[model samples]
Structures are given as C-alpha cells and as structure tokens.
Target: MDWEPHARRLADTVLRRRESRWWNVLASTPRHVFVPAWWEHGTSGPVARNGPDDPAAWLKTAYQDTTLITRMGTRHADHTTPGTLLPSGPWPTSSSTLPTLLVTMYRHAMLGPDSHTLVTTGTGYGTALACRRLRDPSLVTSIDIDPYLVTAATERLDAIGLHPRTAACDITTNLPGEFDRIVSTVSVRPLPASWLHGLRPGGRLVTTIAGTGLLLVADKADDGTANGYITADQASFMRTRHGDDYDTASPPPSVWDAADGDGDTVTTSRYPLLDVQNTWDIRSMLELQAPGIEHRFHRSTDGPRTAWMAHPDGSWARAAAPDRRTSPLVHQGGPRRLWDTLETIRDRLNRTGQLPVHGAQATITPDGQTTLRRGRWSATL
Candidate 1:
C-alpha cells in the first residue's frame, strides 16, 4: 500500500479550514518515521500504541490532528512494557503536538525568506516541517532538555535525509543560537528573558503560556524589550520539563475532595457552570486572577452538573446544578475568592462585549519581567 497518497490526502483534509501555507511540507513528510510509538489517555490512564505492531493504524493516526504521546512521565514509548506503571496520571512529558496547533504557531510567527528560526524539538516532526519550509538545516535550531529525546530526534531527522541543528539544553537558560523567529511547541510561564536576548532586533516570537491556553506573540524592539498581543485562538502544550516529571499542579487531597465544601463566601453563581479551559477568554482571565488553579468537570447520566475549580493557594469552588442552563450553587473557601474573581471577570467581559485577553498586549522587559496589559488591568507573570 502506498502511504504517500494517504499522507497527501491527510494534509489536504487537515489544511482545508486554515491557510494552505504548509500543505506541501505536511504532504511530503513521513510522520511515522518520527513517531514510531505513542500512548492515548484512557479511562484508567494512558495505554501505549506500538506503531510498528500496526503499520496501517500508525499511518492513519500519524496524519490526523492528534497529539501522539511519545513519552509518558519518564517512560518513553520505545522503552515501555505492557505492564509498566507510571506513578501518576498519563502526563505527557514529550510528544508531537497537534498538527493544527503547530501550524497555528508557525503562521503566527510569519517567517521570512532570510529568517533564522529556533524551535523546540520533541519527536522532531515539527523540526522536519520547519526544515521543509525554511529549506535549510543551517537556518533552524531545535532543542530539547532530555538528551535521550535529542538523540532520538537527531537520528530520525537524519533517517529522512533532513538534518537541522539539534541540541540538548534548557530553553529558559542560555539559548543555542540567535534567531529571527523563535517558536516553541512547549509552553512556558513568563516569557523567557534569554529568548528576548537571543532574538535579533525586530525579530518575532510565538509561544503558548503554561497553565493557560494563551498564545503569546511578541516582537523585539530596539529598547531591548519584546511586545506583542495575545491571539484569540487558543493553543496549549506540555510545560517545559527539567529532569523528568512536571511539577505537580494537582491540589491537595483535602482541597480536591472537599472542593464542594463550604467556603468563606458562598452564593449562587452569576453564570452557569462552565468548562473554563474550553473558553480562551475565561480560562486566561481565571489563570491571571488565580494562578495555578486546577479545574475539573463531571456530569451524571441524567442528573446535575458539577464543576470543581481548585487553587494551590488553598482555594476551591464547586458549582452544581440539575441543568447547565440554570445558575449553579457555588461553594468557595480560601483567603482569595476565586469563584468571585472569575465571576467578576466574566461580568466585565459581558459588559465590554469582548475579552481583554483576546487582544491583550504583552511586554517583556530586558531583565525577563513579562506583563500583560489591556485597558487598566495589568499582570506581571
């Protein structure tokens, strides 16, 4: 069976809704060469998919707009057994990001003919795409913190006769090279100062903020600062890992279990229960008001809906109702009223008829301080 025609069809279908700026690269690149095995989040946890064991399935999944989890926690799919157990949830340490999101970041970066690019390499499929577009391994530098990942990606890129500058290093620390465009598939909290220092004047950077699905786009100015606006479209990726696992964002057992318990201030919710993460504006605003808050949602077969929102700052809120159309009974506890803050932000958005976060401006100072401002609200992350 010829896979090239299938790859071309996949690219045509996936790029139908977006600009066809990268159809050629996706159509020609062989995804299975980069991602041989991956995992899927199951009801209990993640289950591994051995690509070589099923070539047809691998070809189909590789071209879809889905994230292939190449590494779970510390266990790479290449090294995992059928009974290997991870300590926690199927947290993806590294993977090939969704193709749509990858293209979105690249589109936002707006690379030019003379632009030198810096990108993060996970499975290296993205680096392959970049090399295809930029047409030079010399103009692209891709890095990952895990030496194993870097080595594997280097080997895979070479297998396809495409070689870019691949390195193992912490992206937040000293970068590998100067770049006209810095695009990261992994998320970071505050914009890294090193990125600003490494970006040539008038260069652009596109990346997602950790803990929220906010895409940050900025351009370096002559004053040694980078400033840009948030895009309305949302995209998120795994947070940059240092050693192996990500820092736990799960709330304490007490706070998580008693999320619906009484609080310092309790009242009816201004709006119905919502999956904040699904909304770019609401999630971004809540993340700003209460940093590092964990959110969850559940519903019975034919009963009420429950939304649990918790923060590491000892705050949690539960909104419950028989139907989502009706207002939810809310319970909150902590020094800070997280639900109230979310409601306030939502109310402000309702009044203003738009989210400030949608087009909020971001500024990164020379020393690495990052700030987001819209109207009178400004937050330094």
Candidate 2:
C-alpha cells in the first residue's frame, strides 16, 4: 500500500507550519519501514502488532504523530509474534519517538548546512530524518549501546538508500568522534562529560534530564565550559543505559509495606492527595529537590484513594483520602520527611506562580558538574 499520503499528513500536523525546515524531510521519510512492528500496552499486558499482517493498521499507526514502542524490556517487537501477550512490568527501553519531539530537539540544535551530527539510532528513523535534512548521509553518525539495535537500524537505513556511520557504544562514555551537533533521544543525568569533550568548539548538544521533562540545550565554550538554559518546552526520554537493560533500582519491599503503618510523625495534609506521577511540574520540582523518589497511587472504585512515595534511603510516605475533595491523612518515616518536602514544593508553587527549575539557567564544567540557577535558587546535579 502507498504510504506517502499518510506521511504527508503527518508532516503537516507535526510540523504544523509549512515553513518549518523539517517539514519536507519528515514528509518524505517512510516511518513504517523503520517501525514494521511494535508493542502496545494493553490492559492485560503488552500486545504485539506485525505490520506485514495488517497493512491498513500499520499505515494508520505509523503516520500518526505518536510514539511507537519498539522495545519493551529487552524484547524488540520485531522479534515477537503477532497476538503474543507478554507480562508487563518492564518499561519501554526504546521507541520510534514521536515526530514532533524529534523535530523539537533538532530545532534546538539549529543544524547548519554542513553540520556533522551525532544522533541516537533508535529505529534509525531520526537518523534518516537527519540525513534527509542534511542532504548528506556521510555527515551523520548514529549510536546505540545495543548491538542488535545498531545492526537492525543500519540495515533499515540502508534499505532506503541512506547510509551513515552507525556505532554500538554507550554514549555516556567516550564518544566515537567530534561533531558540530549532538542530539540525543535518550535522557541522561548530570550531562555526560564525554559528550562535552567530544564536541567541537562552539558545538551544541540537545538532550533531556533523566528523571524530569527538562529539555536542555547547551553550547561548548573555548574554556571547556558550557552554558545554556532549560527550554520551556517539556520532554522526557528513556534514560541512557550501558547494558542490555536498565539496572533495577527500587526501595526495599519492606519500606513499601511499612508506608501505611503509623509513622514517626502523622498529621493531616494541607492539600488533597495528589498523584505526583501525573503532575509534571510538581513531579519535576520534587525530583529536583530530592532525587530518586518513586511514586505509587491507588484509587478504589468506591472513591477512597491512596498515594505512596518511597525512596531508596528508607524514607517513605503514605497518604489516604476518602475522596478527592478531602485532605488526606498522612504518615511518614525514615531519615527525612518525604511528604513534607513535596508539600513545601507544592506550597511554593501555590504561593508563587512557578518553580525555578523551569527555564532555569544551566552551567556545566569540563568534567560534567552541572549547576542550574534562577535568581536566588540554585541546584547542582
């Protein structure tokens, strides 16, 4: 089936403005070719879809301005059979990221006519877009830690008569070479030092903060320091990995079991129970204030709700409410008051209009020491 019309429609919606530099590049690329199969999270688990068996569904899904989960855990959808359902607990490790977000990262980099670019090779779709936009395949270098992903993406890219350098290496370590621009679909914490070292003088790098929806864009300087600001636009990507799968890091099960018990301190909350996982700004601010807090929420059919916050440091908080309109009964334990910190952040947001992390100024040293500042507020990660 012909897919050009769908691709064109996608470009119109994703780019929105016809004058966008990436409009033509996105319109001409065959996304379906790269995402021939993908995993869909169903209520039961993960459901697989094979493009060859369902052409109409494939075109419809591929052309939409939505992400297609190509890999869940270590299993790539391409290797899974249709109608297969896998138990779902593992998070998505890779995807053909939504077109709009990819364009946003590219635009932030401000790719020049002759810019040599280093980009993530997930599904190779983003690299194809870069190749088309640059009009020279040789100017692009794509990398992924997974050897299988690199091999598959290389073949798919070659199938479209586009060939660029593809490497299987952890981006957090030493990079393959210097480039004018670096755009990563994968997120990282503290900004990788190797990325800054591999960047040519005056080079720009665009990536997201690991645990927050923070899009960071910075340019290297002659002094080996980079300075920039977080973009107002929000985006999140899977954190970078050095192995086949991310290392499992969670609070001990005993901490979760004790969260509901009587705490060292218990009181009524000033605000109604909130699922921090669903509130981006609050979640982002909380992450900035105290990193590595895992949130969980449960709502009963009758109306009662419970929210939990757990940290690997043995800190835990639980709040329960009869309904959304009522304040929750709170409990806390461990080295710090996790819930109180969240409330303080929420209070700041309520009292003031916004959080300092949004659009904050970012400065990075030669060794990847990152400092974000806004007025009197500052944080180093």
Candidate 3:
C-alpha cells in the first residue's frame, strides 16, 4: 500500500498551526515502519493490532497525530499476536510519542546543522526525525534502558537507511557520551546528575519533570549547574525506568479503601469536587505542593462524583459531592491534609488566576538538586 501520501498528510496536520523546518522530515519519514503493530487501550482491555494484516487501518492510525502504545508491562505489541486482548491493569511502558509533541521538544532543543544530539529511543521514530533534521546520523545518539527496545530500534533505523549510535543504559545513572543537546522523551525527578555530567558546557537539555507536566529547558553552565525556566507548554511522559518495568509504588488497596471510608476529620469542602488528573496546571501545582500523591476520580451514571487522594506517607483525602456544582463533603486522615492543600492551591488559582509552576525559574545544581522559584514562592526536589 502507498504510505507516502498518508505520511505527507500527517506532516501537514502536525505542522499546520506553524511553519517549521521539520516539515520535510516529517513528510518523508514512514512512521508506519517504526510502528508496525501497537496496543490500544479500550473499555474492555488492551487490544493488539498487527499492521501487516490490515494495511489500510495501519496507515490511517499510524499517520494520525496520536501516541501509539508499543509496549505495556513488558509485552510489546510487535511480539503479541493480532487481536490479542490482555487483562487490564498494566500501564503503557513505551510508545511512539505523538508527532506534534515530538516537534515541540525538538524545536525546544534548537538543533543546529552540526549539533550533537542525544535522544531517547522509544520507537526510533523521534531519533529518525532528529537524524533527518541534523542530516548526519553520526551526530545523533539514541539510548534506552530496555535492551530489546535498543536492539529493535537500531534494526528499524538501519532498515530505513539511517544509522545512529544506539545503546542500552539507564539514563539516570550514566550517559554514553557528551553532546550539545540532550532531548529525553521520558520524565525524570530531581534531574539526573549523570545528565549534568554528560552535558557539555553550554549544552541544552530538554525534558519534563516526573509527576508533573512541566517542560524544563535548561542550558549547562560553566559551574556544572543549569538554569532555565519551565516552559508554558505542558507535557507528560513515562518516568525513567532502570529495569524491565516501572516500579510498583502505587498506594496499596487498603490505603485507597481508607480514603474511601470515613476520615479522621470530615468537613464540607469550600469548592466543588475537581478531578486533579483532568487539569494539568492544578495537578502540577498539587504535585509540587504535596509530592507523591496518587489521585483517583470516579463518577457514576447519576450526578454524584467522588475524588480520592492518597500519599505514601499514610495521608489520604476523599471528597464526594452530589453533583458537579455542589460543594463536596471532604474527609481527611493521617498527618497531612491532602484535600486542604489542593483546595489552597485552587483558592490561590481562583484569586490570582494563575499558578507559579508555569514559566517558573528553575535552577539545577551539579548534584541534580532542582529548585524552582517564582517571585516569593519556591520549591525544591
């Protein structure tokens, strides 16, 4: 089947809002080659689709401006049989990031004709775009913690006649070489020290903060520290992983059950129930204020809705309301008041109309300590 037209159409869609030099790169690259098969999460479970078996659907879906999940819980779609449906509960482990987001990240890097770039090899599509943008495969190096991903991405890139250095290493611990630009598709907490060490002086690193939607663009300084501001554009990526799968650090069932039950202190909330997961800014601010809080929201067919927040520190909050417009009855337990913190943030937002996380000034020390400051508000991670 002819896939060029689909790819060109995709490029047009992705670059329609703005003019970019990546237009030709996106138009010419065959995204279907990089994503031959993928998993789609549905109401039932994750269903696998094999590209070769359905060429038309493959071309259509592959060219769309959407992320295609390639790996979930170590089960790569490439290795899974077509029409296979897996039981729910395993989250996506790897994917070909949406084209527009990829362009946004690459544009932030400000890659030049000869810039040495280091990129995460998720499906090799982003690395392919970088190679095409640089016009020299040797100037691009791709790495992944999953050895199978590294090997498969390397072979796929080679099949497309683009060869760049590929390695399997935990990016949190070490980097293979120094480069002018480091663009990661995965989020990291407290910026990794090895990234700082691997970055050449004056080099730029573009990545997102884990557990938040803050896109960080920092340039290395002579003193080994990096200073930059969080971009107004928000993005979220899978956190960096050292092993085959991400660590299961979610709050236990008992903790969630406790959050659902009556709280140590129950009171009526000042505002209506808001699902933190739906709003990026509010969720990002709450994560900054109360780090490691797992949020869950449930809405029944009727008008009632409930939101739950649980932290690893034995703190949990539950808020339930009769409808969207009504105030919620909040229950708080343990040491900290998670819902109160969220309400305080919401209150600030309602009063000031903004949160400090966006465009916040960020400074990362040589040891990977990140400090975000905006006016009088400051936070460290």
| Candidate 2: Cα lDDT at 173 | 96
Off by over 4 Å in 2: 300-302
* Pairs of residues clashing in candidate 1: 263-332
lDDT tens digits, residues 1-381, model 2? 799999999999997888987889998999999999999778899899999898999999999899999998888999988878887577899999999999999999999989999999999999999999999999999999999889999999999999999999999999999999999999998789998899988999999988888899999999999999999999999999889998878788888988978899998999989999888778888888898899999998759999999999999999999989889999999999999999999899889889888879999999998899999989888
> Per-residue lDDT tens digits of candidate 3, residues 299-327?
98669999999987789999999888889
Pitting candidate 1 against candidate 3, the one with the higher TM-score is 3
In Å, residue 330's CA in model 1 sits off its true spot by 1.3
**Residue pairs of candidate 2 with colliding backbone atoms:** none
For candidate 1, the 10 contiguous residues with the lowest summed lDDT are 81-90
In Å, residue 143's CA in model 3 sits off its true spot by 0.3
Residue-by-residue lDDT tens digits, candidate 1, 298-376: 9876578988888876788888889868898888887667788889988988898876776889989987788899898
The TM-score obtained by model 3 is: 0.97
Using TM-score, rank the candidates from best to worst.
3, 2, 1
Error of 1 at 124 (Å): 0.3
